[model samples]
Target chain A: MNGPIIDITDLSKFYGKARGIEHINLEIGEGEIFGFIGPNGAGKSTTIRILMNMIFPTGGSARIMGMDVIRDTKKIKTQVGYIPSDASAYSSMDVHEFLSYCIRFYQIQNGEQRISDLSELFELDLNRQIADLSLGNRKKVSIVQSLLHNPKLLILDEPTTGLDPLMQSVFFDLLRSENKNGMTIFFSSHILSEVQMLCKRVAIIKEGKIIQLEDIDNMRKKQLKKVSVELADHVNIKSFSIHGIENVITGPGNMLSFMYSGNINDLVGFLSGKEIINLMIEEPSLDEIFLHYYRS
Target chain B: MNKNLFLKEIRRNSVSLMIWMIVITLLIVVTMSFYRTFLENQSKIVGMLSLIPKGALQFKGISNFNDLMSVLGFYAANNVIYMMVLGSIFSIVLSSNILLKEEYDKTAEYLLTRPVTRSEIFISKLAVLSINVFILNLVTALAGFICMELVMKTPFSIGAFLILSIYTLLLNILFGAIGLFLSTLIKRAKPITTFSIGLVLIFYFIYTLSKITEGAAKMGYLSPFRFASVDATNPAYTIDLWHLAYFIGISLFLTGLSYRLYKRKDIYT
Candidate 1:
């Protein structure tokens, strides 16, 4: 409570010679909705697992609420709720049975009411067997279980894999409401839009390393966009040459497409006198952004 | 041990344990039902058994035809193999899967993330394995006792019968420990049921081979089955101290090793 809600210092995990994560340092303040974004197999789960004490780190250390993740895992888990990437529950158990099992782990008053409230919010049938639930429904169950105890810090790894758009909206809204009530969240996903929607700050991991860490607004404010221009007539590359234009490609119909990373106004001013049939500026996809980061 | 986890595990495994108990107790009853017939046709049966190779008879744990003269000997000869092999299979399969099944079922995320330490989880599961093994032994052995009482032409020594029951229980527990050790040694979360059953058979094969072949008598020492003496008809029969030490020592060593390995195991689901 006195410091960062979660602190990971120079953390590293190696599976023998293969890398899991290396010297990955992070600090998340209290009441923060922090995002950990990376492509699949990019050590996002590795870092979260270490924090949850599901696995140990090969080097360095991690702590939550000023207690070591390994040594104080039992105590830390009493206040931390985690939803794993895969929505695999005890399939033999019905929703009510499984949820009851999970809630029993925590000492709380009115646990049955808490289970019912969350299940209704997710539209989960209490009597439906987990094995019979759809992927989306199972994801809903996974989500509800993590919130049953109202943990102070929630760790979600790819929490929205199978939910429909409507349920996703409900889930995100619930997350926002939870954050408003001072529950710090560590949300991990490969989807840029979702991370960008809810997270205040994010750390982008690439190939088992923290490649980029910045505020979500700062990330967007970096102004990296795909610029595609179709000229009325053919123009030499020198005609529209400007700072921040990269990977320029000339195509049929005089289309010039490239990535732009600098001021949009400067580019607009430079294009004012040019005869252009169409000019487009769009946000790049997460992979494209990663490529840009790698190239930069 | 965490009582919540222990109780949950017990409930989860109850059906399988119940099935094992029923099957084994039934086997004992069915086999013991023939004790009166074996006595009624003793002369004719002796002639037929004499023609059969001694080693073939010994493989079923019958050291001599005369061993079957007593009711306890008949039980040891006819019914011990069912509990020995099937009970071992049950013990091993249960132990091997008790911890790793969470990983195989991809429910380790739920179990490992709980507000419980690894030690508590390990010990709780181990307790379940032990209790299941004990329950199976108690129920089947009690069934054998009742069946013997019903069919006995003359009363047999309860003391020797108790000793035989203890040996069988010890052997089953040793298999359970072996299974736990094997599960922990596995680097992946795949079911090792076939491998576990095969190990029990292989050990039985070694014990039988040592008994049947004069040259391979020393090979029996390599099998835990050799240490479980089944000669209930012999007046001098008792639980050997060295054999007891071997079973307890290996079981304790394997259980300890499993606990240590599981605490630091890099679980992947």
Candidate 2:
């Protein structure tokens, strides 16, 4: 119980000769939101499926709550709540009926109350058949079903793919509340902002391999920030190098933009002495961070 | 654990149950009515009826109709062959829906995430199909007996009826297993259904071909339908113990194989 809730060690999966995931190792602690960031076909979902025990790993092992995933899949599944990227329910069943069916499979008490709460939270209509609901609404139903059992661990793949902005915030709030109650959440998202906001630590994946796994704050500190200064007239761009800046770009001899990867104070003093009209500083987006990591 | 899941399956397949019931009842009524009219010409009909093979006559389980209409009425009643076919078709219809529905609705991922193991889920669904098949055969047998009584006024030995019912149930299990096996192999519902129907037709045709050709008679052994005695005159209307054993054995084997394959196969698109 003192160890991480999820421990994946040297995990690998292959589809025929092609590698699905390779030498993947990570640990997610209780009460932590671990973001798995990757683009399409980056093995994010594959790793999650292995954790969920939907399939076995080709090499290595994964343990959840001190239980081997493959050996104790039944015990593991009961304690984990999973929201698949393309969640679907029986088309013939209405929302309430579908939830009722799922509830019978678990040992949860007071399932009715949980279902009611989730319906209210997601603003889902209980009477509508699943086929009648829109894609986003179906995703909401999936979320509700996964949460209804009050699982100890949550594995969600692309959890916010189909949600509007307001609903996405609601989902994040729900996840935050669960994390506060000591649930371990391991989610994959292409949305960097969501990961930045929800997760304390993240693992960036590319082409079936982990490119980087670090604390969010540390990642932000390590990644470069861009600073752009609108110049009054053409001047020597090399002067910007005084701030320990690199990759400077001058457009039409009036604008100077360069990537800053060092201390902010150096740039502040260097800019204070220049004849600048306006200055803007912003951090690089998640894509840029991933791109940089990927390139390296 | 299995009992509750079995009941749920019966509820899901109630539509098919009702249809089979209606068809079996109508067959009983029509056959009895026709036999009654034929019996009116007693001299001509009795001679012709006697000439028919005893096995074929026993297959219908109809004897001298005290109420001629009633005797003929149950002629179609004990047609266990027809009942078995209906049971097999229903089994396929119900079992084929098991996996494909989850995949079609995109609920496999959600269902797989539950605390239950893949083997447990597979077995649960198989258990449901088995129970449904058993109930279906039981209902058909009981209803057929009742129709026979209403039409013929003749009583049947409970033992003989029970044996026949057991045979039909075994036949259902065999076909249901085939359906379940196909569900795992195929990803779509339509192909599985069509292939199941094709299998039924092929087995039936093989059974008939065995009867017509000298070397082909053994071919009947290959069909689950052939294991159940459609002709009651041979006193072998009861299912052969070996055949019953084989049916159950194959069913379990196929189900186990499917579970193993599904456990390792990659699911995500």
Which candidate gets the maximum DockQ versus the true structure? 1
Best by lDDT: 1
Instruction: Name the DockQ score for candidate 1.
Output: 0.78
lDDT of 1 by residue, A56-87 (tens): 99999999999999999999999999999999
Question: What are the models' TM-scores?
Answer: 0.97, 0.82
Query: Once model 2 is optimally superposed onto the true structure by TM-score, how far is the C-alpha of residue A86 displaced, in angstroms?
Result: 1.4
Give me the runs in candidate 2 sitting further than 4 Å from their true place: A106-109, A222-290, B2-10, B27-33, B38-78, B153-161, B186-191, B213-215, B235-238, B259-269
Pairs in clash, predicted candidate 1 = none
Native-referenced TM-scores of chain A, all candidate models: 0.94, 0.88
B1-269: candidate 1 lDDT, tens digit per residue:
99888988999999999999999998899989999989999999999999987876876657788888789989999898778888899999999999989988889998888899999999999999999999999999999999999999899999999998999999999999999999988877999999999999999999989888878989989999999988888889898999999999999999999999999988888
lDDT of 1 at A292: 88
Clashes of each: 0, 5
Regions of candidate 1 where Cα sits further than 4 Å from its true position:
A229-232, A251-253, A263-282
Quote the lDDT for B196 in model 2: 80
Interface RMSD of each: 0.8, 1.8
Tens digits of lDDT, candidate 2, A184-211: 8998988777888899999998778898
